[model samples]
Target: MDRIPILRMGNFLLVTIQVDLYDRLAQNLESDLVQMVSKTGARGVLIDISALSIVDSFMGRIIGNIGSVSKIMDAETVVVGMQPAVAITLIELGLELKGVHTALNVERGMQLLKEKILIEESEPDEE
Candidate 1:
């Protein structure tokens, strides 16, 4: 599997990759994503899963892992572009992503991230 593509835009990190439903794509992806979150302290992440045709246990676990790490780093995770079939499969499989967030599309995810950043920035300082 190919390494996931990553883009850093302002305070958001965008990831694009083809998930094969099997293999180490998820693990490889997490490595790159973790680096981005750690290095930039990015306020949010947009994971584009449009290319994936299915979601399996491995993939679901990886998503959960990414969410945990991101939370630890103070970054929010938003999965985007997940297909309907994939969504159903994940739900049926009982893949409970404890702390991960999802969006119907990348644009919406980006908007959510922007709002989060804006709110965080605008909050008054607490002594």
Candidate 2:
């Protein structure tokens, strides 16, 4: 299994993992990813899935799990670049993601993350 690599871009962290199938890769890093989110102190995350060909129940679960962990770490997780076929396959497989953020590409994903950060930063303090 190839290791997931993490890169920093501004306030967001980009996690790139090469995988033929999203499920397998997610299974491999479920725990490690959770730890990574905690350790990095990242405000947001962009998961580049341009390499994945398909998504299954396993992948959906892992995505959901990562989102849960990211929430606890106060980081927003955005999955990016899922192919149309893969998206249809995931739907047909009855694989449902539990409210995790998603984007069509890395740039959009990063934009969304940055916007979230900006919104948070701009919020007025509640006295």
Candidate 3:
């Protein structure tokens, strides 16, 4: 069982996937990530998949699940460093990842996360 490391940066959690993920591994990652977010109270999650050259529907769904869980926990999720081929494949496979945000790299993703957090913080809370 391979465990994906989740690094905490300020109010954000960074997940960098450097190897191809098997089904169980991906599933575990999703579960672990959601738990980490809840435990740490992170405001944002940055998933860097630059090293992944291949992704199937299951993997795509796991990513979507992570994003959804994060949002429900009041945190934003940003997927970064997606390979061009993987992006095309995901689209062709009909996995649009609707609720997940994307970025070209980690730096841009971090900036985006910060901006999003700021915008969210500025918004008035609903009674």
Candidate 4:
């Protein structure tokens, strides 16, 4: 069983997928990420999938599920470094990955995540 490294950078968790992911690995990642978010009280999640060239429906769903769960935990999820072909394939597969934010690269993703956290923090809570 392989575990994906989740690095904590301030209030964000950074996960860079350097190799292809199988179904079980992806499932474990989703579960581990959600747990990390809960335990660390992370403000956001940055997933860099630049190394992956292919994506299937299962993978897409796992990504979406991660984002959804993170949001429920009050953490934002940004998926960055998606290849053009993979994007197209996801679109063709009818998996738009709703509720998940995306960026061109890791740098941009981190910037967006930070900005989001700032904006969210500045907003007043509505009762």
Q: Write the per-residue lDDT of candidate 2 for residues 1-127, one digit (tens) a residue.
A: 6667677776677877575545555666766767766777788878887887766677778878888888888989899988899889888888767657999998899889888888888887643
Give the 10-residue window scoring lowest on summed lDDT in candidate 1: 17-26
Candidate 2: regions farther than 4 A off: 21-25
Q: Mind giving the per-residue lDDT tens digits that candidate 1 earns over 1-127?
A: 5677889998888887675744566777888899889888888888888998877787888888988899888888888898998888888999866788888898899988787767877787643
RMSD from true fold, candidate 2: 2.2
Can you rank all candidates by TM-score, best first?
A: 4, 3, 1, 2
- Global Cα lDDT for candidate 2: 0.78
In model 4, the clashing pairs are none
Off by over 4 Å in 4: 125-127
* Candidate 4 lDDT (Cα, 0 to 1): 0.94
* Per-model TM-score on C-alpha atoms: 0.87, 0.85, 0.95, 0.95
* Per-model lDDT: 0.83, 0.78, 0.92, 0.94
Model 2 shows how many backbone clashes?
Answer: 0
Clashes of each: 0, 0, 0, 0
Q: Which residues of candidate 3, in runs, are more than 4 Å off?
A: 125-127
lDDT of 4 by residue, 76-105 (tens): 999999999999988888888888999999
Worst 10 residues of 4 by lDDT: 118-127
TM-score of 2: 0.85
